[model samples]
Target: MTDQLTQVIAQATLKDGMRNSTDSLDAATHSAKKLARKLFEGLDEDKGGVLTRDEFEPYFKNPADAAEAFKVFDKDGNGDIDRKEMRNAVSRIYRERRALATSLKDMSSAVSKLDGVLLGLALLITIFIWLFIFNPKGTTAQLVPMATIILGFSFVFGNAAKNLFESMLFIFSIHPYDVRDLIFIDDSPMFVLEFGLFSTTFQRCDGQVIVAPNSVLFGKKYILNVRRSGPMWEATKVMVSFDTPLDVLHEFRTRLRQFVTDHPREWKGGLDVNIDFMQNQNLIQLSLIPSLVVAMEHKSNWQDWGARWDRRTLLMKEMKRIMDQLNMTYKLPTQPVSFMSGQNKSPKPANSLLGAR
Candidate 1:
């Protein structure tokens, strides 16, 4: 009888274990379905029932999660998930409980910092108001000292308040375009650092910082690479040897024009090439002007494209190809001759190039 009872107990234990395993599997399946539904619901809101990368990305915490989700959702061998397939897939059961906890912790820290700043500002304002209301009155000897003290404090506080208010206004009034919108100013290229209420600060590509007032930026005539809303303007000037043949010069212009035409994506629109002769010192100067317009908005890094090594390399290669085609000996000058100064100091009649020479 004892042996019979032992066998029955073992059977019962096995049955309970099987039941637990089945329950765990059911729970896991349910959790996965819930997660998948959440992901699909987010995507389905925009479309009738579709999933795109942009729509699905916000649900993923990291690249690995995204890859895994994509693998599960991609029912076909196409390597991407479509709306219908994504809705059909079972979601994973793992909850992002840790991520939610971390986010809440960070939010608390930010709120604490903001509160401290507000308290400090409030205290400073209270002190200023107290001093203004409790002015001291006495004999001329004591009155003069009191007046001086009040004046000194007033001057310091007034300037500080003015600066603070102006900064607040500037932050609230930021617009699409303002003074800090150009690649070059006064013909000198620089990197814009920040735009403030009263002044603008910029660092040159070579690491020199320049500070100019807002008024100065508004007043200046500078070349701007305005994105999408306008055309991208680029000017290239080449000075060829005086002895270069006219055929060589014409070939150079043609090659430059062709290069611009070939690179449709890089050079968006038409090309303008101007060839002119002038007198430089006692020698003849041949100028090849190529102005190409690229859609400023299309270039990925319009603001910093010039500083990119790859862009510079591409530009240099194109320039070298043109130079080789023309068989021209040329000098790339650091500065271009200013037409205003050149015209103003002309020694001969305005219409005649020979007379000027």
Candidate 2:
């Protein structure tokens, strides 16, 4: 079977004249299938019509042809062949031949590629011969030192160059995020300070600078928070004792929201402020931590980041003052643990819980 398959492939090579042809991998695979089918049709010893592994072993010498032949005839691809499938395989072979015969573009494309290959080879040989005859060894080396340098550089920095270029293209073309636009890269919130040719500069809240190579940034995805329709939202949160009246908390939140909404332009319009109850603010176990959420619009310097910071600082201060004015209970961190000593200690409803701590 192996020798017969080899002879069939050899006959196909001669019949199709692929030895001097510019056939693609698909074309070569098709040719192999044709050759296998041609050989299979002639095998009739101990065969029940369909070509199984046992029946196919008599004709398919090459493993590749055998595999391809099985795939061609296995129409339903259940890994076996039937009489109907074997018959249909003949039609497929005929159709493939007819299609190839009628495909002028395929023929032209093959011829054009063949011409190009031949011309390129001829030119390369001509240049090599001329260089050998007329050009000195030193002259050849000197002329191509630049090409060598470029090749050497590519070997060293090709990936970096590709990444940097892609990053630059992304920065300028896609505009993923711009300067002053808040973004998170690698879980760190950063303000984009500058976008450079090969790196990006970011400024953290502590005045520390972060210099990331463009390649590093390009390699990882980022969380981009930008505004198109309106000013970006800034969320603030503060925790307070549960002793604070719910009505007072609600009033404070309502006042803040109304203040921002009434003068929309001052807060950059469409001020959507929210204050909600939260579980213990800290992740560690604490129940009814009674947290206050704040989202308010403010008018301030977007460029300097002072507006948001100033507004946040002032709002925190005012909220603290309001809580104090209302005489709602709160505690200082350094307050002595006199209650622990039971010295002049009495049961105070507000101070009985961990909120005091």
Candidate 3:
């Protein structure tokens, strides 16, 4: 079977003389699906057509770990994984592996830039030191004038020198964020564009460029590195009337879960739909917070901002559809109106109104 499958894939790749790039992509996808099928079949030792927890125990030493892995593969909480679910799980893993590879490449590029900058600085410093130590004209008296000039310049730019030193320290010691990293500065998402000795350049999702001094960023009490931390969790609240039927609420949660399940590539596996809070003071409104794994699509962390908003918008539209179909009622808080002691509750008679003829 393996030899036959390989032959089929090879034929698909080397098909008729008129093959194009799309043919190659199709062949690759076919090969991946075949491999996924093979893996799934191998795991079904009992030939039961579905994978059970026992089939996974040998690979995972801890029973709890095995159960968790099983749960991921079993998309419908069916306690067993069918061929279709296994294939989906395998595809997800493939995408994650590709994403990891891209992230590593980004890190490598960032480090290369850092190395180049450091090397340039080191060479410049070494040139000055070499000239001072191995001066062809070796008299201390000969260098006194140059030394005086250097001192004068240093004194004139003392503050700049201090900032340079501090910037160097920030680069070497802190290492909080890297080029192409998504970071939050003053609650705004900033994509690190270039890391310079004195200042760093950042770009916002809307394409605004910001150049901030290294001292300013380094002195901040906190920096949120979104990429290094992995995916973020975001929640959307839905306000519904407290009197909504239990069955309707159950269906609401089920539909949302189904949506997430249908888009495994866009959202993480699980979701949290719970009662967030209630407003009983002014109105009776129940807030249901459905927390999801923030959608971060691109290998570059900067793209996460756009992807997150896009996913949220999609989820909100889905929620609106579900609410409309279920006929769920959302209640708004009521406000009280107060009138002054002498104020007329009704408008003056039509004849007495301003500008009356």
Candidate 4:
């Protein structure tokens, strides 16, 4: 079966011009495998995995080749092919073809670009040889000094060029963010608007655009991609006086949960409310982490941001209503001040040498 399959694949490769007549056995075999998988799946009628000799005949000009292909595909000596057998036979073939195509495309691109450079190098080499053969002493004297200057110049500026090279690497390889993606750089949220080879343009929420080099972005502490993250909790902190009862805090949590439940579209199903901290026996800081539903269907991050902003306003308003219902008062910090009864009297001097004088 192996020998017959190899023969059929070789014949197909030759016919398709995928393998030249003078090609080595290994080269022909490798090329034959890529083209065979493309033909392997096309003959299946009724979208079924099995391919009888009749179904394979139209793909091949000769009936003998079709019969041979059926025997190779039909494992376990079963008259029909099943999905398992098809998977085992064609999966590796498809992978090899895809990999070979990608490698060839990359190689062709690299070689095409270098072709011009190589031609120019060849011309320069020919001229150099002619000059050396005719006037070796003078040519050597001139070339040595020219090469030294070029080396020194490169050494002086190579560090500066490294930044540009790193920028290219960041843009092409790391790919930290894409256009329209909402990312936080240095804790400031910005929307990516454009991507250049060496720099990226970002738009702040306040409508300011920043063009930062890729190298600079790569050096930041961290870049947070909001678009790639899950729904985030919107926190609202409130200070309540120590006199407030525990029952009131419990009621606030319950009401906040109910609000999230009622507005299912704007908020997620769950929430958290807790006493985050307490001041010096004065007030308790209550923290609410209300999970805001991410607007994934929006056209852009800006639209999503706007939608979240409105939802936050609604949440705050609902919170205010709940607080008003429970008669909850905010505990604002106070400062003590003293006023003198006699405004016209002179101020007292400090208790120092100046006061004694």
lDDT winner between 1 and 3, please give it: 3
Task: Give TM-scores for every candidate, taking all chains together and pairing residue i with residue i.
Answer: 0.41, 0.39, 0.52, 0.55
lDDT of 1 by residue, 164-248 (tens): 4554344334322332344666667664545545555677768888887544454344544333234344555666666677777
- lDDT string, candidate 4, 1-357, tens digits: 235455544443342344334454355455445444444566566666566778877767799998887766554344666554454454333333433443444335434644655688699899989999999999998998889997998899777567656765676567676555688888798987666655677899999999887777766648888766776766788888877899988998899899888865456667888889988777888988877775423311223577678888888898899989988886666644433437666544344334568
Better model by TM-score: candidate 1 vs candidate 2: 1
Ordered from best to worst lDDT, the candidate numbers read 3, 4, 2, 1
Name the weakest run of 10 consecutive residues (lDDT summed) in model 2.
Answer: 290-299
* Residue pairs in clash, model 1: none
Task: Highest TM-score: give the candidate number.
Answer: 4
**CA shift of 42, model 2, Å:** 99
lDDT of 4 at 340: 40
Which 10 residues in a row give candidate 4 its minimum summed lDDT? 294-303
* Candidate 1 TM-score, true structure as reference: 0.41
Off by over 4 Å in 4: 1-143, 296-303, 333-357
In model 2, residue pairs whose N, Cα or C atoms come closer than 3 Å (at least 3 residues apart or on different chains), thus clashing, are 2-61
**Better candidate by TM-score, 3 or 4:** 4
How well does candidate 3 match the true structure, expressed as C-alpha RMSD? Answer: 9.3
Error of 2 at 116 (Å): 30
Off by over 4 Å in 1: 1-151, 174-204, 207-229, 243-245, 280-301, 306-313, 330-357
Model 4 scores a TM of: 0.55
